[model samples]
Target: MQDQPLNAADFDAIESTLLKYGDDHSVLNPSELDGYFTALVSSPEQVDIAEWFPGIWGGQNPAWETPDEAKQFIELSVRHINTLARQLAEDSAAFAPRFEQTEHLGHDVTLAEEWCFGYLRGVAVANWTPLPAIQATLLQAISDCAEQDNFELPQDLDVVAHQQRVAAIAPAVRALHDYWLSQR
Candidate 1:
């Protein structure tokens, strides 16, 4: 439950297990999965995890070889995700949201694009609404990310520039969280 309790090996283990169990049917990739949990717990309103867990499961039939494995997976995932949410909202300078596994966003836009989708899903399912202008603008930026597949980028912003834009999403998420919590 500590910040970044899962090292690379731990992450690999979890991801591989989930994938083996058909969790990839989930639209939220790993980074967005992190964002989803973070958004839920960061919300000003109380969120019932029990109610939301099924939605997070995303209708993926359990493919774990053993039922116990499925149970343990859910328990571990929930614990880690709750820890992530708390750490992100605390805004410790040492901690950043784990939107991607590597230091860089990626050579392509897909990770951020998936991340935006996941984050937006969290916001939507949590029913966080009527966002203030700044947060709304940030959501708009994320929306642009969501459109990465269909929308054409200007020729000037090459892959490097696109990656930089994706990397910039970390701060935008922080700002959105700050904006929402300020109402308290």
Candidate 2:
């Protein structure tokens, strides 16, 4: 079966539909959502863009910067990342392309949710900033993952195999993660 090609337009349609339904169960505020979308549009990356579609990880980029700047970037990045993740959890259809297997759907979602949250928190706390909202977004993403009790298969989607793909980018995320951890 051909994988579903879910792009920005698909997500935008999903968002519009959700808004028309008058649901506010999103993990982020309006501005944060905007920030996430803006980041994607301005500079498309793999890890983040993959977030809009299910079962696909747009492998996270490693960050590099001075101590103070790193802290600031972490806070903002977490806020934006969690916001997009939250939107995914809220509207699964928009992301159904990623979850192609029923048996491990829940597990995958949970992993993704936790990974995003843990990575966000790990980076944020590592930086030691007073960005409470960023922390809240991370917590919220975790909560959303916890609330899911079932799994579904992603239809016609592209799967990002973490192992096969990390070859080129592991150093960056690790360096960023380690740098933040070192501050503690």
Per lDDT, the best of the predicted structures is 1
Q: lDDT by residue for model 2 over 36-142, one digit each (tens)?
A: 23223212122433343221112232233356543443344445455444444344233211111223423332123323333333333223344247444443443
Q: Give the candidate number with the greatest TM-score.
A: 1
In terms of lDDT, the poorest run of 10 residues in model 2 is 53-62
lDDT of 1 at 95: 47
| lDDT by residue for model 1 (1-184), tens | 4344666766665677656644554633456666676667656675676655655667434545888777766766676776766666665344465554323323344246666767766776678868878777877877787677524445554667666767667777777777777775
Give TM-scores for every candidate, taking all chains together and pairing residue i with residue i. 0.75, 0.22
